[model samples]
Target chain A: MLHSVALKTLHDQRRSLVGWVVAVVLLVLMYAAIWPSIRDQPSMSDFLDQMPEAFRSLFATAGADMSTPVGYIQIELMSFMGPTLLILYAVGQGSSAVAGEEDRHTLDLLLGSPVSRARVVLEKAGAMVLGTLGLAVATGAALVLVGRLFDLSLPAGRTAAAMLHLALLGLVFGALALAVGAATGSPGRSRGVAAAVAVLAYLVNGLGGLVDWLRPFQRLSPFYQYAAHDPLRAGVSWPAVVVAVLTVAVLVAAAVWGFGRRDVRG
Target chain B: MSSAPVERDDAIRAEAVIETHGLSKSFGHAVALRDLDLTLARGEVFGYLGPNGAGKTTTLRLLMGLLRPTRGSARVCGYDVWHESTSVRRHVGFLPGEPALYPTLTGLQHVDYLSHLRGADPYPRALVLAERLDLDLDTPSRDLSKGNRQKLAVVLALMPQTRVLVLDEPTSGLDPLAQQELHTLMREHVDGGGTVLLSSHVLGEVQRVADRVGLLRKGRLVAVDRLDALRARSLHHVHATFDAPVPVAAFAGIDGVRELSVVDHTLTCAAPEASLDRIVKALGQFPLRDLTCTEAELEETFLAYYGRGEDDAA
Candidate 1:
């Protein structure tokens, strides 16, 4: 029954999902194809060293010391491509969960059914997780292909873990979006709030990585818990996973409880 | 048409499909419904009559578990509207005043989605209703006209195999032929021992399908009686044109007569019932040119309650 609901949601949103998937795939291919040629330049090491910490924080860690043939792949894929993919999925899924229903005026229709309001939110969120998971798998395969063609020695376990980490991060954002969607009950306002929150978190996470004062504020952002390179390539952060899980749980619970009691007349 | 009288108590029996006790709902300073007590017996086609903003839609929404009441309570098939909303929702088929359906989906998809939510595949009934109503299943809702949208809503509400129906202005957008079809459909449902609470502004529609009518003014039910009884209570306006000026004094002291006016050579009398024999006999002495009589419409009686300032502000 749960799967049926999720599948219904997917079929309802199949057009939009297909469009996003194609766009993401093309984007990944373009970046992956263009990135291999930039790895061979002699000035690459000096350029990596000269790069500002803030700029480095925006994408991934780039440095002369880590400038091996494989390091080029690490700096580009882990820092830049991975987080961008994660954020895109997060924003897309999060805004669509509640706001999409409001847009279609199906929220009232859905609520009018035998299903509980909590189940609607959870089911849509679950569908988003599945979609993001699919995207992650596609991105991982594309990354592996790019690595092989470019002669970049990418660790299979670490790369797969990174993709999984990104997928989980997307879910966190998606759940937060769901909460916003449920609370506001307007697609435009919910999407705006979710975007603002996601962008703010990303900024805080970036600044914390670059500056010392903002480091303390880093704990507040969900991104701080998702250190892409360290997790997949080096080691896993159990604390970060716990914190992410807790954040998702609290937001979703609050959303469901709030929605359950709300007068869903609209 | 006279048959055995149905007891008022049994008109709404214990096997009632819907019951509300003092169900009051208010939006901030505006009172939508106040002390609303309603009961719909099994197999009865009930009409809920009220003007715009008379809390008709609000009442239906509350019954469907779409809106929670501010005070008091209601039960659908013995299931609490607020506490056990899911159970209540499962058994009730609701047609909102303006059903905001998914515009992109075809008529078939609309039925499929609604049935899917109810945890039942309502394809057979949906197809039957669509064919009966002449709704094109292949066409998307946006492509359909207002009447078709209403048809889709009706199909969605009726397709579900539920005993109780809470329909609000179900036939508002349909054409005359479609309206006739809907009336036939509703009667069939009632004959099959299904209950329906149809809220509508059109009295003729209600009179045709509803055995009992509940007249609502503002947020309160002013009259709840048999449709025929309610009609019998309304005044009939009779006008008589004489060849010469006629004295209105002869029609005096009549039981049902409320106001009598004579202008030029015409005598106009507004009364609960036209005393045709007395009126004609009295006019025998005079040269009566023309006589026309019109019974008060149910809407007029409804307006009379409201027009007299009976909670018009509500």
Candidate 2:
């Protein structure tokens, strides 16, 4: 089964994956724990309201209330830190899927077996998806645990929806990285291209609301689809979720096609 | 002896386990393989001999369907390599010149993963191979020495019990004992009616184990002959110390003799196997004190072929 490759890859990544999950969970819990202190200070909400619109928009908290649990978590965790960690994790795994095998000179041995090139690409992509989903679940669980301990009254459905969006967002970058890796057979190049896209998209989405000129290009970034509806408060937007899913599908198809046609150079 | 005709027919027929028809591969403008034709019969060990950059690895890649040929075609176990690669792979086992393994996986895990990929249970055979090769399966592949890594690769390729084995420099990093064990394993494999395409630059190893050898030079096959036939055709250095002065002319103009010379009471000549009787007859004319005839090594024979142009090779 193609899933066998995914299982094997996941097993190989088990140790490092635990570390990433632990770090993400700890980061989430640490941020969630501090929300109560900030929520108790009425002066803090006044200070946030007095802040310049441009400065607030830069952090994606312009229209949202800073004192509320959903608004605070969106600004401090979900909007930037959580999604960034998940995207980086997915991109790392996706880029390593094909290009890493070539870089390590292990692709030849793997392909020498009876497995098809398409299966290899698809299976590795499957592994990346699994890892990204695992990260999302870990982060979501941490958020829930800390929210309950701190009495933040976080809505369970909205939190799950937020995690679902985050996972989809990670899938977009992961699939892109996989596609680039398949075409180039170079992990460094794949990572560079994916990271460049991620950083540029992030900046365009974050700054688009603050600057009038960048607003037109904001929708072109995947971060717009992820953050536009604010899934942590409004629950999942089906259109944005569909877009993310379709983008991942297209990129994964490209990866499998490119990998099937190219020579196993390494 | 009674199966010779049947085996010959099997080799010529479509039943040849591994066959290539004018297979060629080019990397952009540089040709790696050109108009190469090869055939291998079941239960035979065919050595593919060449120097570096002689397309030995390229040919193996083409047969494995890792590289598509620019022209013609190749088949393993009667399946076209490029078109039906999965089927081809199902019947053939391959070991590359350098075996690269997953670093984090222990030797046992690597075996398990590969076997899982192939949809076969290899543990039993793997255990036997580990014992034979003296491999430690618990060690991480990253910690294994080069020789151990090679042993792991060998076990992976052989454990599947595939019909054909394509091994490129299979003994490159093996210790002497391990190398001997590999040769024994290959012999045993062939004895079980398996075919092997063994590619290497080591002439002595090929000469020791291969029933037939194909000498490749500059991406072209220079010669493909049985070991005995190649030995017969190869030049042998003959040195004789005579009791009396023997005319060098007596050894000249003989079939398969070349570079005849006489210095003092010593006579020296190069002769092929066909001229042995005639040379002995000529040497009998003089009272000889000592004589020695050394057959040219396979390396020297291949070197001679390597020095020849394509036209000469053809």
Candidate 3:
């Protein structure tokens, strides 16, 4: 069938992909447009320093600076907004992969083909991965390209590393959504599970710095791997990337395994 | 001439394309299907008849491996429906009741994608089916009429010419003209040594092409017989207007009488072949003003068997 499932999935997502890309470009431009003004204000750095320690630890990464381009992007985009956009897109695709089809009563038509269940799950997951990665590249290109126009320059290698970690963070939750969707053919419920777990993981990673008891489990959170080492500053962390990649791989395998064993909702 | 019928019967028995052994499915305590042991052979159309929610859809989905059985097993083309579903699907074409299609895709795109998924180019066959069914291949499914959508579903399912056709209420949204065309297609499918399992609550939908019929009720198969055999015992509507008011007791104990009522001077009821003479005799005892005896709809005959009760077919 020439990877028909994957190709068809991507074809179905063409419009949504464009919308997400355009949103990314516009968002990057807005941030880049504001970088010049923020850099010109020396008093902005004092305002951040005077903020409560808990607020700084939760929202601002280590070595917070309002004047520097990398720190500004890290505190503003990398800390929250970037991951939110990517995770939303990934979770959307993930939910629609299997459970959303079932919810729409189209799973029967798709599975009516001679393809195996494992192949369907794997191909849909592949399509989601490709869509997420493509969006990540667009975001990176937009950040670098848009940054130049506003006199805000960022290190190329570190920006790429940040984009890589952000993509992995998105993939982790996307795969989780896919696994939950495959196990239970309920789109709303699967998305809810993924979003709730993501919020909890974000809280654990962010609040872990100030909350003593949460420290041991903070590394287990995907957000920690995404930003605890701050890829925008120190560049890529091989160990964190491996952990994020492995989490996605395991979740995809679980999707195949769960889907193979259950009865597909008609 | 007698040997011809025997050879056809032998041909049917020679190939059991669809066989189920004590297949059962349940969603918790609510049993959707129970111990379904049905066999469909090549060169025949078996009409699976039932009212809505009679587990007709459940059986069809099970045969397609869309729903796994809670107990027992089924095989299509000698392939296990659940364990070897991919192999089973390669040989079967299924049209679910109210078949869903991608809202944005055109009929041709569906044909292209589904046929490609089957790993075969059935585009030519699909084009011919679409033409014969008078379906617009360029219209998006969401924009098409219900009848047109159903026609597209038929085109997609029938394109492959698979060994077995599992159709659920295939004619629900079709016009009489399209229904006739679909029936003809089904006949041709069997004539070419393929098997068709056609499910419908209305017996007329499948009677024109079905050689045999199976009635399902509350997830249980209540009756399975040749279409003609069921027709032989088919219920007949007996309506009579008497000159005088007739008591209900006059026809209280006649066998096979259903929907029986003697309201004042009018007596209206249905009875099968065996009870017709008794009903006629009972009418004679009263001075009859008018009498009308006609064959009931095939569905009425079927309902006379299992349609009465608190209908919770789901």
Candidate 4:
């Protein structure tokens, strides 16, 4: 397990982890606080209804009632802002795990010990999972707190389920970044590749519903499984959860294999 | 060559701790290390001397299992470096030329973390080494000076108490006093039956502690022999200024003098140690005003090996 490496890596990232958690919590609270004002405006629903269907679907806000607390939270937090923040945090942490060590010329020192290469990669991936999970839990707690204070009557179980899905979604990108880092000992290239994948996947999922040719390929996108089911309203989808977990597992395995085979650059 | 006995007999009797057979490494089309054959006995401090980019670092990295060799093989403690790297690493302690530490970690934290990874208790040894090197354990590594960071790296590499120590340019950033202290520590380590493979471009540092040295040039092993023997064969450049003009033929018949030249009142030539007495006697007959003899630098000695071809190498 290389417990010491994972623990030390987590310890090193504590400051950045705390900063990200605070940002996610504050963003969730601010959006939840304004939900009452939007619900109070009666004509806001008519305004949203009159808007173009293509525009609403493009943002993954279609079939969501803006006046309701759950609908507003899904669009503002879970669908867009929350995932964006978590993905950024996850990708940054994952890419830096291996490639950053090489960049700083510290990988040789670590590998000089008796630890196996596979253990090092696996332990770093474990640290990334723990960090993203912390962010997700903090975001869920902040939503629950704001919901009670504002009397939005948010469902606690469903919100927790949404946070779990969000965390898994972040894990997929984190593992992808880690895989890229292991393949090439370049942090900038790893981050660029993972970020590009995320952006392209999001676009395909967003525009899939309107374009006929893209609709068939939407299921291939992780974002489609992430937002298409609306876990906040209908609870967790087992198939989607399976796909997310499988993606994380496959990417992490690839990272370990790639790292074990390559030469460690000094 | 001097026939004085080497100080340690245990080193001669000990089994080979490190051995390489036709070891070669190339990056793309550029060869970093050529087909090299070498061996180091247990409890011996073997100095690896070479110029920059002369395959010193490449050889160390190959032994550490950080880079795979393109041909042949290297072994540590009788285990192949690439096939049984974990076992090799368990027995070896290494200090890289450029030591990189975690910026957020303090020196003490780094020690603890690395110690934990090695699955050993190094706290006691670490504290003692830190004091010897005059390093602040509480300072963040990023905030420490280069010499301090080097001190920290030395502490980490030495604290593990492994069987073999591979140090590459270990004294690079250390002050003179600290370097002296490190030399004392290395001698003690070898005395206590630990094998050391030290690679450095600094010739004097290696000459002080090494029992024998292997000279490398252009990725090839040019020479390997006892330090005293190599020193005996080294040539010195002699420049003598006389009160009157002297004939170049006066130095021609000296036992080990060569390339003798006379320009006006000055005479210059290369002389080996064995011919020093004859040359001094010959110079005394003339009116000598000023005389200076400079011992050949390590680089010059290395060039001398090439000048005479591989047959003349000890």
Candidate 5:
């Protein structure tokens, strides 16, 4: 706890991280338990096909081949639930990094020392990145390990690639929240803005296939950089990774700039 | 032995460790601090006295770089306050008005974190301060009493042992004994060549430790004087009961006489220590049957400059 800012931040979130890891494991376990029955029924694929085109596109990024492990995992985990959990976790951590400290009035204690404002923001961003990536890796490992019990042998390399994209996706939103919180010094406002932007970005990605006008802008959403290339089926997209990483870098820089130029609230 | 006088002369002529040149701050239309010009030498405690919302906190924040100044500039240990705030903060140990700690962190953890940020070892001096303040270092901040939390904050601010300490209402929540200990610590810090600028609403608290005092009223520094000089200028109550009635005009004409009242055979008035001789000579003109003179407390001295109006500030 007395170490550098990044280490201290991770230390502070240790208990919450454990809880999140447990939740991710349980969620994967539930999906694994249901997979065998769905694979044997064959009618589950028909049910997915019968759904409205918009609903079908919203839920499934790849083709709705529920019989195969990769397609099922893509439809069930990659498109929505996985991103939602990771993004929520990232956004929460980022928003709380600066504004939450100020809200608790402990910022004076930390800032009173010789630590520069920019360093605090940058180190907190480093913590968010590490935590988000660690959670993504856990989610991926859980998916592959639990899927084995249900005869769903997903490729380890493809799963790692997908998790990589997912982690970067989470980082984008996390950095946005961090920037907002640093600029405004209000945790609630920061969370609200980040959530709103995420919802808008999510809608653009989910409805992009059905809505013609939303098609071009879909590529602009962080979700597009995450799942549009179908990292689960076609492992790793360098362009998407570069874009997401660049987005996170710019946002973190903005956070530092925003925090540096303003009066910190007590 | 002869070098002692040379060092004393140099100390007298030493550049002020804390200097603010016409520093000012305002939030929109509301002025928090205006045209503050102050200087503090090493080995001195300068008490900042003001009611709430008189820009005491704002001034401290500006000095800390938490809030940038709107006009002019300030320097702590020769570093610019706004542009070079990190440097200024390197030398200044600040205790905020309401010192909030991490609720889950224990006192020792808080000290460790702060000292580590300053890149100093944690235990030696912190343990000493904790023992002196009677604080339980193992207790989490949320569990600590208000005074205990204050004690922990005090330890953090003083542990670094920086060149300057800017404390905002440092003794607000302390018990009398702890307050005394804090005052003693401030004196010791100043004696060790550290400058202190402490703010307080209670004149008695400042009077105990400050060599010089600055009074703030409505965003302006109205008075700055040596504590001894201020005390010398402090008003004294003079009450005389003569056998014959004294003329109201006799004492009314005296310098520094305020609130003068001469009714019937009794004359009661407040006059500065300097005006005591003239007031007494006026009383001597008539045979005085009874005479009583007592020095008023500095609280009254503060009130004389600042009326009893809380609504005017804050």
Candidate 6:
């Protein structure tokens, strides 16, 4: 039954998926076609090093080897692109699942069926999970092709782990959006709030990376927990994985509880 | 003051349906329901009648477990709305006054999504209902007109084989033909032993199908009676066209008879039930060519019950 709902969500959002796919293709081409020629440029890190440490830390991983092919991918794409795109897609998709129902006046119709509020919450979450997975898979495939073409001997598992981290982080963002949607009565307000939360997550995590005192505060932003540098250079951090899993579960549970208590009269 | 209690009056009972007792609700200062009592029998076609703000929609919302009542309580299909909301939701089918559907979704996709939420296959019944209602499956709900949106709401409401149906203004945007089709489906469902609590403004439609009617005004139930009883309590006017004019004096002595008149070889009189037979017997000797009797029906009686009178303001 849940699979059916997920499929329906996909079909309903096919237009959005198409747009994202086109954007992803263009992004992959830029990394594959444009970035490779500049990998050997000695002046790249010299130019980046001139920027303030705070700004530099926010954009690229510290100690990253910009002279190599795989390191260049990390510096150019995974540092900024991974979290930003996932955050955008997660907020846009997840907030609408519930709030969009209110906007369309279909909440009454859905509630009137033999459907429980909890089940609705679960189905919407399932759709977001699948969507996040699909995105990770697409990005992983693009990275694989680019890695081979550039003759970069990067291990497949590391990039795979980074994509997994991206997807899991997207799931967490999606859950936060779902909770916002459930609490606010108005869809437009919920979307606005969700977007603001996403931006805050990015800003805190980004700024915390460069500043000495703010480094401790970065844990508050989900983006800090999902930094691909550790997983991309070393391996998946089980502790970070645990945090992501726990936070996603907690947010989704709160969303279900809130939905259960309130009146869905639309 | 006592009359024979109607033998066929069976108290409604439902094993898995929504029920409310003395349910009352208010928004800030506006009272929505006041000590309202109702019983929806299993598989019974119950018609709810009320003017605007008469608490009909509020009652349905409570049954759907959508809103918490300020006072009193409701149960759905033997499930407590407060304690067993999930169970209550699983058995009840509801249609709101103006259904707001997802504009981006096609009719098929919307049904599928809702069905998925219910943990069931959503499209088969949706397909059948669309066919029955003559709705195009390809059109997005946003593009559908108001009437078409209403039709989609109907499809959603009736597609589920729920034990209880709580429909508010179910026919507002329907054309006459669709209305008739809906009536037929409702009657068929009731005949198959499914229950319905239909709220509507059309009196004639209610009269044609309602076993009993509850009159609500300003969030209070002023009258509850069987349709026939309401009509019977009011005065009836009889118009009899005879072969020849009968003398008015012939019916003057009858009790509870008034306005006896004979003109153009026809006789007419206004009387209650007791005097009706006597008046007819008095003119038995005359050849009766045409007789047309008109009763003060439930509609007029209902209007008069709520009619504004001089004393009402005072």
Cα lDDT tens digits for candidate 4, B218-297 = 78888888778778878889999999999878888887687789999999988777788899999999999999998987
* lDDT score of residue A10 within candidate 5: 93
**Higher-scoring candidate on DockQ, 4 or 6:** 4
DockQ for candidate 5, C-alpha atoms: 0.77
Question: For model 5, how does the per-residue alpha-carbon lDDT over B206-303 read when each residue is reduced to its tens digit?
Answer: 99999999888888887788899888889898888999887898788899998898899998888889999888888889999999998898867766
lDDT, candidate 4, at A135: 87
Each candidate's TM vs. the true structure? 0.89, 0.91, 0.90, 0.91, 0.95, 0.80
User: lDDT at A206 for candidate 3?
Assistant: 82
Task: Please give, for residues A63-110, the per-residue lDDT of candidate 2 as tens digits.
Answer: 567688888887788767887888989999989999988888888788
Please, what are the lDDT tens digits per residue for candidate 1 over residues B43-159?
Answer: 888999988888888888788776778999998887789888877777777787777777778888877777777766645898998899988988988999999999988888888
Worst 10 residues of 3 chain B by lDDT: B1-10
When candidate 2 is compared with the true two-chain complex, its DockQ is 0.52
Strongest candidate by TM-score: 5
Query: Candidate 6, after superposition: displacement of residue B112 in Å?
Result: 5.8
What TM-score against the true chain A does chain A of each candidate get?
0.86, 0.94, 0.97, 0.95, 0.98, 0.90
Task: State the fnat of model 5.
Answer: 0.73
Native contacts recovered, in order, as a fraction for each?
A: 0.50, 0.60, 0.73, 0.69, 0.73, 0.65
**TM-score of candidate 4's chain B against its reference?**
0.86
Clashes of each: 2, 0, 1, 0, 0, 11
Q: Which ranges of candidate 6 are over 4 A from the true structure?
A: A1-3, A150-154, A209-213, B1-18, B28-30, B101-145, B234-300, B303-314
A1-266, model 5: which lDDT tens digit per residue?
A: 66677887898888899999999989988888888887898998999889998887778885878898888888888888999999999999999999988888888988887788998999999999999999999999999998898788899999999999999998899999999999999999989999999999989988987799999998999999998888988889999999999999999999999999888765
Worst 10 residues of 4 chain B by lDDT: B1-10
Off by over 4 Å in 3: A1-3, B1-14, B237-291, B303-314
- In candidate 4, stretches whose alpha carbon ends up further than 4 angstroms from where it belongs are A1-3, B1-14, B240-257, B262-267, B277-292, B307-314
Candidate 1 lDDT by residue in tens digits, A42-158? 576677667777876765542323445346555665665666667666656666677677666666666667777778777776777778788777777766765567565567776
- Clash pairs (backbone) in predicted model 3: B53-B313
In model 1, the Cα lDDT at residue B149 comes to 91
In candidate 2 chain B, what residue range of length 10 has the lowest lDDT sum?
B1-10
